[model samples]
Structures are given as structure tokens and as C-alpha cells.
Target: MTTRFYRRTASVLLAAALAFNCAASFAYAYSAPNESDLDNHQTYRNHDGETVHSPAHSRSGEAPDGATARCRDGTWSFSRHRSGTCSRHGGVAAWR
Candidate 1:
């Protein structure tokens, strides 16, 4: 009986170890690229003349430029060219 129990225990332990190793390998195989892949990226210039570097996996598109105009109520959304940007921000910017 003792020998049979030992055999069963050893077999169960071996099976568990194999299953864990297989699961780990499968997870690693399907994983996405790591941080080193992000080092290879592209840089773009926004309207504010600031350079913006993005990783490979980042969303490929343009984000808003720098400060357009801030309102007295602290409201400044995206507005290009700035023709009528100050009006939307409640008249000329005070630069506060």
C-alpha cells in the first residue's frame, strides 16, 4: 500500500509539473512583443513644434497640438489655425 501511494503521488506531481511547463510555454509563445520592441519607433511633430515619439504598437494617428487657448473657466479644446480659437475660450487669452 505504501509503495502504491508513493507511485501515485510521484506520477501526479510529474503530471502537474508537465502541465505547468506546457501552459507557461504556450503563454510565452503567444505573448506580444516586449519593451525592447517599443524602442524602435517613429517621431512626429505636432502643431506646437514639439516632437512626439510613439511606439510601434501605439495608435497611428495625430493627437491635438500644444495649447490652443485656455478659457477663464479652464476650458481649451482642439482648434486648429487659431482663427477664432480665442472667442471660444471666452475672448482673447489672458495668458494667466
Candidate 2:
């Protein structure tokens, strides 16, 4: 009877620990930054100690809005697509 009671007590303690851990994680979520505060992008610093460009959310066949891209032909263009090809130039494109 003693062993059975000890086993039940241990099971209750384990369940309480697991519940507390999950609740703590959920509470911490309240402090996470909003999605609008973070956007998809990439940044690079030029030799002149300046940020050359800060690219933002962009997609293929859309206006580049001043961003630049490199084509497979070793030329530069602006286009962001899954194909990595400039929709305007018909060549594989990559962010410069």
C-alpha cells in the first residue's frame, strides 16, 4: 500500500511540473515582438561604411521599388521570383 501511494504521488508531481512548464512558455509569448515589427529582408554594408540597400518584402513581376538584382547573364536587374529569373528580362535573377 505504501509503494502504491508513493507511485501515485510521484505521478501527480510529474503532471504538475509538465503543466507549469507549458504555462510558463505561453506566458512568455506575451513578450514576443509583433510580426509587423519584423519583415523579410537582407542588409549589406559597403566599403564606404554605409548600408548600400535594405531590401524589403518583394516578389517577381512586381516593381522593384529601388532594389537591385543580378541576372544569370552576369548583368544586373531588379526582380524577386522563386525562379530567380527576372520576370522582365527572362533570365535567372539574384539579389545583388
Candidate 3:
């Protein structure tokens, strides 16, 4: 009975650890990219001459030019306004 208890405790601990790891991975995967991950030269200015968020991407590849945001669907946004940016593309994953 003692051996069975120990085995069950170990199994439970291992399962808990796996669950936590999976949750952490999922959260990190969907979070916004860091500023350092972006290409600073990709930024553009609006009509008011104010600098806007530029297209940001990981090392996977380059985002399109004039892109102002990265969509959750893995697309780039060129919207001049932020109100509805990426509304149709599963919402904005990260504002560029």
C-alpha cells in the first residue's frame, strides 16, 4: 500500500508539472513580441508626422512594408487608425 501511494504521488506531480508547462507555453506563444524582436526601420509616420508602430516580426521572415500591426491570423496590417485594425483578422496579435 505504501508503494502504491508513492507511485500515485509521483504520477500526480508529473501530471501537474506537464499541465503547468503546457499552459505556460500556450500563453507565451500568443503574447506580443518584444520590441527588440522588431525591425526598427520598418516604421512609418502618419499624416500628423507622428511615428506609428511599425510591422514587427520574429526571425522567421520579414513583414510587409507599411504594416502597422501584426494580426492574430499571422498577417500584417497597414491601417492608419488603430480602432478597427485587424478586426477581421482574428484581432491584433501585436501592434507594430
Using lDDT, give the best candidate's number. Answer: 3
Per residue, candidate 2 scores C-alpha lDDT tens digits across 1-96 of 699999999999999999998765521111222224224444444433434333333334342444455455443332222233344444555663
Candidate 3: where is the Cα deviation over 4 Å? 1-60
Task: Point out the worst 10-residue segment of candidate 2 by lDDT.
Answer: 26-35
Q: Which of the predicted structures, 2 or 3, would earn the higher TM-score when compared with the native?
A: 3
In candidate 1, the residue pairs with backbone N, CA or C atoms under 3 Å apart (3 or more residues apart, or in different chains) clash, namely none
State TM-scores per candidate.
0.30, 0.30, 0.37
What number of backbone clashes does candidate 2 have, counting pairs of residues 3 or more apart or in separate chains? Answer: 1
> How accurate locally is residue 90 in candidate 3, as Cα lDDT from 0 to 100?
86
Q: Write the per-residue lDDT of candidate 1 for residues 1-96, one digit (tens) a residue.
A: 699999999999999999998765521111232333342344444455544332232132222133333444444322333334445335544331
Which of candidates 1 and 3 reaches a greater lDDT? 3
Among all windows of ten consecutive residues in candidate 3, which has the lowest summed lDDT?
Answer: 25-34
CA error at residue 25 for candidate 1, angstroms: 0.3
